[model samples]
Target: MSIQRIAAAATAALAAVALALAGASPAVAGSPHFIRNATTASLDGVSLVVDFKEAGLEAGAVETIQVTAHLDALYQCVNNGGKVPSDPKKTTISSDVSESDEFTAAKNGNLVGTLTVDPPDAASVLDCPSGQRSTLVSVTWSDVIIDDLTSGASLALTGTFSA
Candidate 1:
């Protein structure tokens, strides 16, 4: 299976699972791991909960970041007790890369994409807190477009992981 597909499945399954922090432990190099973070955003009648997974990392090493944008629920103001359009399954969420878009989400709400975390960004997002030793996955949904919207199409989110 494609990497994206694998990531999507993992993300969906672990959406509600939280990983406990190891409490100020030194990050071991060459170890694969998972970090989870989430943020909520709303516009018009639709609400989104953006979940992030920083996976496949070895301490300060750079790796792929998985993003998931979920439609809060089927019934909302626009839908008026009805389901949203049948297009969320086709909606694509991308991570910004050097003035371009990269890492589109898969069909199952898993934007299975990898981002190379540079030194500066890495220092902020990947660095664990004083009493924590887990990666922080930051996700800013500035340009994520939910195509095939009939109205109230604008959607944006600033979901960052706090240290």
Candidate 2:
């Protein structure tokens, strides 16, 4: 091809490249500007209460208790649009306890249990990429019993979370 023709074609290609880059420039590297809003919802209450069936028996008698709890994510994430990842479950309870008059009873008890859903490994949500959202945690307690004692008995369970 002629030199003039080749030079003209090269100039046109360079101009097109510059225009494309200008149109698709990278986003400014600064904190994202956001608008905040607050909303309220009724808090769902959950508790585990245990009462001793037997009042009086030998002091040495032993008793056993079984308990369980649940954790879940209730709110949807709103980001570029909106997304809801699978609600992760809490795998382990940080704290659990049973109180009784029996001498054999543990001062503080730790029990073996399982989580119905898989808990997210990280702090942020998987599907949502924007503002923070709310999640629900449900815990249940059952099959707790206290050994024979001179006085009435009861059980209590507690839990802690890792951030």
Candidate 3:
């Protein structure tokens, strides 16, 4: 090949290499080093009780009750054994009551006030190319209250996420 032609070809190749290197370097910077996956847990067969006592004029006033729950979960893509997620939010315990009795002082009574409790949060170890990481999550619930009533009052509560 002619000298001028050879020099031009070499310059073109160098330019192409430079462009590829620039593009590739930026892509590497933009690429994420770590990946994440979803995990879930559930607690079943949980139970709580509400006790009632006569308070002044009001009847069947709630004193206190025991609370218990079972926990379960399905974990996915857990790496970095040391790093795990935990729940920082609060859970609530509530109750429901019926007012069919005519002799009841109040149609509905605040048998028990809302009580906030924190439960263990979901955890996972994030696996990454460089290393492992830890993550924490928060759990929350809606308002849980015990209503007023005569007898056979019922209570139900469910877990939820916070806003």
Candidate 4:
């Protein structure tokens, strides 16, 4: 190959990498990684499928993390002919709940966080039947993490909520 051609090729490759780095989201700054996989948790009528990508977390570093999970309480109104309650606070259950637990990263490098759903109350919008539990609220996480590891990376975990 000619000297000019080789230099041009090298320059193009460098530019391409620069562009890719420039366009990357701030959350995923250092150490590109992929989430281990999806995990499903079912308690009472609440169901969740959680997945995320993380970097810089050591295999044994336990940290306190908080994630703002977006909830879907549509099922609470299903029994009432799909009628949504006028008062947001009058839902079958409270969508805003906090869960705290010591999470241990497994050998496979997965930090699993499970949100415990509150059981439906009697004043819930839906007149649920016995054993026909309805999920008052279903929530999802968005790259929620705590503690800084060796690298700075963002978590973008997203998936469908099956409740």
Give the candidate number with the greatest TM-score: 4
Runs in model 2 deviating more than 4 A are 1-44, 55-57, 68-128, 137-163
The TM-score of predicted model 2 comes to: 0.23
In Å, residue 21's CA in model 1 sits off its true spot by 29
> What TM-score would each prediction reach against the true structure?
0.19, 0.23, 0.23, 0.36
lDDT of 3 by residue, 1-163 (tens): 9999999999999999999888762221111111111111132222122232222223333333222322222222234565432532222323221212122322233232322233333332222234433232322333333322433333434443242
Clashing pairs in 1: 105-111
**lDDT score, candidate 3, position 36:** 13
- Model 3 poorest ten-residue lDDT run: 32-41
lDDT, candidate 1, equals 0.31
Give lDDT tens digits, candidate 4, residues 93-123. 3254434445555444446565453433434
Off by over 4 Å in 4: 1-44, 49-55, 74-98, 106-154, 159-163
Predicted structure 3, TM vs. truth: 0.23
Per-residue alpha-carbon lDDT of candidate 2 for residues 50-134, written as tens digits (9 for 90 to 100):
3223222233334443322233333244333344445533233433333433233222221111112233323443333436343
Sorted on lDDT, best first, the list reads 4, 2, 3, 1
Q: Candidate 2: what lDDT?
A: 0.34
lDDT of 4 at 139: 38
TM-score of 4: 0.36
Q: Which consecutive 10 residues in model 2 have the weakest lDDT in total?
A: 32-41
- Candidate 1: C-alpha RMSD to true structure equals 25.8
Name the best candidate (by lDDT): 4
